[model samples]
Target: MSTADDTQKTKDPEYLSTLERGLRVLNAFDADHPELPLSEVATITGLSPAVARRCLHTLLELGYVGKNGRRFILKPKVLEFGSAYLHSMNLEQVATPYLQKLRDQTGDSSSLAVLSGDEILYLVHVSTERKIRLGASVGTRFPVHATSLGRALMAYQPDSVIDAYLDTVELRKFTEHTITAKAELEKRLRKIRQQGHDSAQDELDYGIVSVAVPIFDTNRQVVASVNCSTSTTRVSREKLIEERLPLLQDAAIEIELALKKWPFLANSLRG
Candidate 1:
């Protein structure tokens, strides 16, 4: 490659190494590791003890983290970090019509979610009139191993990215159907990718089932996901396989088109 080619390959220096490390430190905490001592944080983030302390102190000062005795825990104020992305993406605004239409067509609950670290964060949710519904709320977070939307996003990630993420995240089984083994999870995700949708049954919550598909940008990069959820008792697995999957796939195509035309996200749309 020529010098110009090498130059083009170099990453932007102004991205700020310190800021990136600080964010990584924040990501080291989750439901399982919600509170960690300085040493644990250092180990999780691969930062020196002193550096982790400094970073945690800085976060505490910014109201993003709080110290409880020897352990550090995230605070509610940290939600602003996620809220900023939600506001910037305008995901709810873009997905509302599609979710509404899906709910109307299938008479099931629909949701739009995005991956954040090892979890899926719901940005848009539309409820149905079913007496028994899958209770999911906007801004709720669920493990990647358990949720249909999470599996869809994980399935589309590059092999390297998926390996790195699976290496760091613990695979906890939420129910009997949850795939906890790394090899098994990868195999399942590969099937999901090949089939163009993820069908999860009673994985995240008992008696809940869902079908999900990736929502792509103009560049065809998976930017987010959409899922239709119902109670396990109300819908048979065979029906979801033969019916709901097609509906979810169709909605995904419509979402991709809308995402491509969205004024604010035009620059980020893949393909």
Candidate 2:
């Protein structure tokens, strides 16, 4: 999509210009660019300098942003927004125990994730105390096409939804193992649908291998996915599947049964 299209959408009367503009400014800072100057923020967000300044100043007044020299950074107060969302969902509280069981059984990191746009959003992650090369925390988002969790979730989605995503997404390669072709990704999703699980190795990050299975709600609709991931050095692809696939699948069932109590989430979290 073109910048014009995005700008046009933001012009709709129902949309709040300040909210959109402020979020754009806030999103300009990420892991790679933790600190950005006003000019850089405007350039990154496609907002004009005047608008960026106004948004930043508004955030500063709201205690969500801080300034050091010419650079602007997100403040700790901004975490309240995420905390509120996570607390309200209660997904972490529900899924952590099951993920912990998988972590303990496999001696690896396990996670629960849900579809968010064309990505998988981590809702809970349980990791061993041992240091690891790769790990994701709650709220981390990863490209759907490159993650087993994403494929497991998508495999259960209607064909039209999957096709819509494939038609719009540009599959960028993160590693040699990443499926950059739409046809290949479609084939993978189909296979996941047949096999009831998905696995990936060096797809998103080198040395990070994972297996994931779709999580279903009370009505049998897939709402989320559960995964166990580890470093390549610690686990072979075959062993990872042999050992953790059952655990992950069982955890999915347990989570599904547990999520029954939260009828709102069971109904609302479907892709």
Residue pairs whose backbone atoms clash in candidate 2:
none
Candidate 2 Cα deviation (angstroms), residue 137 = 1.1
Query: Which candidate number would show the highest lDDT if scored against the true structure?
Result: 2
Residue-level lDDT of model 1, residues 1-271, one tens digit each, is 2355436545665556578679989989976999999999999988889888899999999999998999999999988876787688777667888788889988889998878889888878899877553477777788888898999988998889798887888988777778889888889888988888888888877888788888877656677888988887788767875777787788888777777667566444221
Q: CA shift at 1, candidate 2, in angstroms?
A: 6.7
- How many pairs of residues in model 2 come into backbone collision? 0
Off by over 4 Å in 2: 1-13
Give lDDT tens digits, candidate 2, residues 72-109.
Answer: 99999978877886788777667888898788888989
Q: 238, model 2: CA deviation in Å?
A: 1.5
- Candidate 1 local distance difference test against the native: 0.81
Best by TM-score: 2
Runs in model 1 lying further than 4 Å from the true structure: 1-15, 33-37, 68-71, 104-107, 115-121, 127-146, 154-174, 180-195, 241-243, 263-271
